[model samples]
Target chain A: EPEVTQTPSHQVTQMGQEVILRCVPISNHLYFYWYRQILGQKVEFLVSFYNNEISEKSEIFDDQFSVERPDGSNFTLKIRSTKLEDSAMYFCASKFNTNTGELFFGEGSRLTVL
Target chain B: AQRVTQPEKLLSVFKGAPVELKCNYSYSGSPELFWYVQYSRQRLQLLLRHISRESIKGFTADLNKGETSFHLKKPFAQEEDSAMYYCALSGQGLTGGGNKLTFGTGTQLKVEL
Candidate 1:
């Protein structure tokens, strides 16, 4: 079975530094998303991308965050000036269609900000 | 605002016992509900969706619109069922914004021997 793949399984960064998490979604998937989960917290939606543009975003996805489908297979999330609170597990997910509403998630990338 | 609530943080049951993972959501419009599971050291994956109305791994969840719940139920649970389960909701339709999932805090199910 094809699955979404994410890079940098674990990343440690200093405060005020920049970090970029990459993901390669399933080849045929049309919709992609980025979500994060703080330790012991629920998974929170950050942003969704389709057609090479952002479709929607949550308050957590503020000016510090940006997502790009730099290529046909690569989707990335960049956080500028990371803060201590930004430490969390970021997940990349993709969906084949709207009818099923089933999403395939990648093994999250753990980001640690000191 | 769409929110998913899984009241139980941890649930333990013996093998062969029945299991129920409670899930509730708050949404004004029609919502698409799903149950995702993550086994030990495994990536989060979809377990079932309300639209399918079909059971997977002998687990079934009925979407109770009246109570805004989609609780997962499984009779005679096996030890392999031990995992973390999350209930999620989506507010998007066929022609609207992207498919953004709002997930619950998740329930850790431990099927003991």
Candidate 2:
């Protein structure tokens, strides 16, 4: 079965440095999303992307964050300057339709900011 | 704003016992709820959704609009049921935008022998 794939399963970056997390959603999926889970915390929605543009974003997704579908298959989240609080597990999810209300999540990328 | 709450952080039950994972949400409009499970060493996967009204792995969740709850229940739980369960809600109706999901803190279910 096809599944969402994420690169850099684990990343360690320094404060004030930039980091990019990449994801390749299911080929047929139309909607994509990015969520983060702080250690031992609930998963928080960051942004949703459709038609190669962001549809909605949360307050956590501020000016420091940006998402891009650089290609038909690759979706990426970039943080301009990482902070200590940015350490968390980032998940990339995709769905074929809104009606189903089912999201396929990738293995997740663990980002550690020092 | 939409929020999901799972009151129980951890639940333990013996094999063959029934199990119930409580999930409640705070949403004004119509809500689409789902239960996702993460087994040991596995990625998070959709266990069941309220819309389908179908049972997966003998687990079923009923959407209660009156109480704003969508709790997952399973009778005769097996040892394999040990995993982390998360409740999520999607705001996708009128006046609601995007398919973003608000998830609960999750409940760790341990089916002991």
Model 1, stretches more than 4 Å misplaced?
A: B93-96
- Model 2 TM-score is 0.97
lDDT of 2: 0.93
* lDDT comparing candidate 1 with the true structure: 0.93
DockQ scores for all the models shown? Answer: 0.67, 0.60
Top DockQ prediction, candidate number: 1
Give candidate 2 regions above 4 Å deviation: B93-97
Model no. 2, DockQ: 0.60
Q: List the residue pairs that clash in candidate 1.
A: none
Of the native A-B interface contacts, what share survives in model 2? 0.61
Tens-digit per-residue lDDT, B24-54, candidate 2 = 9999878889999999978899999999999
